[model samples]
Target: MANIQDSAQQLEEAIRNSDEFQNLKQAYETVMADEVAKKMFEDFRNTQIELQEKQMQGQEITEEEIEKARKVVETVQQHDQISKLMEQEQNLNVLINDISKTITKPLEELYGAQEQ
Candidate 1:
């Protein structure tokens, strides 16, 4: 367990230095430096979080909110920098998910992976 913890820390450091993380970080900085893009991104994120929270809380979100969120998404997707940031985010997410699967492979083998 101690060895695994040490390896985990090393893996985390490696991931931070990885191309995916570096690209994501650079893309994020580019988006944040543009005030208009930054504001747009923030609005999109806030709207998404609000909707997700409402769903999690079992609250019925109105059609207006859904339409507004859709518009926000559409507008943000039009910005090049914001779109690059989103793409980098997805790239990083894929890397993280792949790593997760690799780390959990042993457990899955031991318990037999179930078909979802």
Candidate 2:
């Protein structure tokens, strides 16, 4: 277990140092450096969180709330800086998903082989 934990930590460090993560960080920093973009992003994030919380609490998300979120997304998408940041974020997510699949492959193989 200790060895597994150590390996997990190493993997985390590797991911932090990865190009995908670095690019994402750079893009985020670039967006944050612009006051207008930063504020817009913060506002969108806050609204998203509120919507998520409402959903989690079994509250209905009204059409107005949905339209508001859509407008925020549309506005952000129009900004080149935000668009690049979003692209970088998506790339980072893909890398993370690939890593997850790689990490789970051995377990999947073990179970699959036994069933065969």
Candidates' RMSD to native? 2.4, 2.5
Cα lDDT of model 2 by residue, 19-100, tens digit: 9899899999999999999998888888999999999999999999999999998999899998999999999889889989
lDDT of 1: 0.95
**Model 1 alpha-carbon drift over 4 Å, by segment:** 113-116
Estimate the TM-score for candidate 2: 0.85
lDDT over C-alpha atoms for residue 29 of model 2: 98
- Give the C-alpha miss distance for residue 58 in model 1, angstroms: 1.0
Clashes of each: 0, 0
Q: Best lDDT goes to which candidate? A: 1
Model 2 regions more than 4 Å off: 106-116
Best by TM-score: 1
Each prediction's TM-score versus the true structure: 0.91, 0.85
Error of 2 at 97 (Å): 1.2
Q: Residues 1-116, candidate 1, lDDT per residue (tens digit)?
A: 46988999999999999999999999999999989999999999999999999999999999999999999999999999999999999999999999999999999987885654
